[model samples]
Target: MERKQFLRTLGTGAAFALTFPCLQGCSKDSDNGDIEEIPSGVDFTIDLNSSEGAKLADNGSFILKNLIVVVKDLNGNFVAASQVCSHESYDQVRFTTNDGGIFYCDVHGSRFDLDGAPLNQVDSTPAKQLKIFNTELDGQILRVFE
Candidate 1:
């Protein structure tokens, strides 16, 4: 190949390698990485009977602490996970009971199990697991923490 042609090809390849990740919605330090993140060492409670907590009744998805996805399982159990999609950094994940309770990411169609394990990935890359938090129920309140 001619030197000029080779140089052009190399430049294009380098550009794509650097640009592909951002286009794929990957998180960056200045962008989506901290958009959903909350202050660390946080501990809070949600009243199950309150209007704000109504959306989390049963098998419901609730976004708390900006990045946390709090879901109520079929058995009325509370589970907390990062709302950020593993494939990308999309902060829109919903709980679905269609396949025995899974978190579905609208951006990349990625599915995560209740324990934050990846059930599926939208691309050839290895699936990313979600960050999970601990939750406890006390009468009509649910406490969430890291």
Candidate 2:
């Protein structure tokens, strides 16, 4: 190959290599049933009178728009939290069937309290607290917001 052509090809390859990683990191965070962006002061309500909404009870939880998980505390109060697992950003958190009032992440065995606080002995390192939202139950309607 000619010296000039080889130098040009090498320069192009180096440029591509340097640009690839930055492009990959620029993608937005994503997951199944996830909301792309949550605006400030978001407030929404779930109708318990509906068929699927009727399934929730005290000490249980329901996933909202697949983004937030709403937990009904043992005292019959409602609480909300981001369903995404902080350690690895998984969205499979659910209430354990026991009386522990905890949300269990199926991905890595992380436990979070109904109030979205990280529980002790989290299996993953650099454990992160779940993002909690304010919740209020008004008759058959449960409102959740950040």
lDDT (Cα, tens digit) per residue for candidate 1, span 1-146:
69999999999999998899877765443343333542357578888899878878755555455567788877768988777676766776667777877888766588889888998868999998877779998888888888
lDDT minimum window of 10 residues, candidate 2: 29-38
In model 1, the runs with Cα more than 4 Å from the true position are 1-40, 59-65
TM-score of 2: 0.63
* Candidate 1 C-alpha error for residue 57, in Å: 2.7
Among residues 3 or more apart in sequence or in different chains, the pairs in candidate 1 whose N, CA or C atoms overlap within 3 Å are none
Per-residue lDDT over 1-146 for candidate 2, one digit per residue giving the tens place of the 0 to 100 score: 69989999999998898888767665432323332332236588888888756767645555554477776766666777776666567666666647567877766678887766777556637667877788777889888876
TM-score of each: 0.67, 0.63
Model 2 pairs whose backbones collide:
none
Best by lDDT: 1
Stretches of model 2 off by over 4 angstroms after superposition = 1-41, 121-124
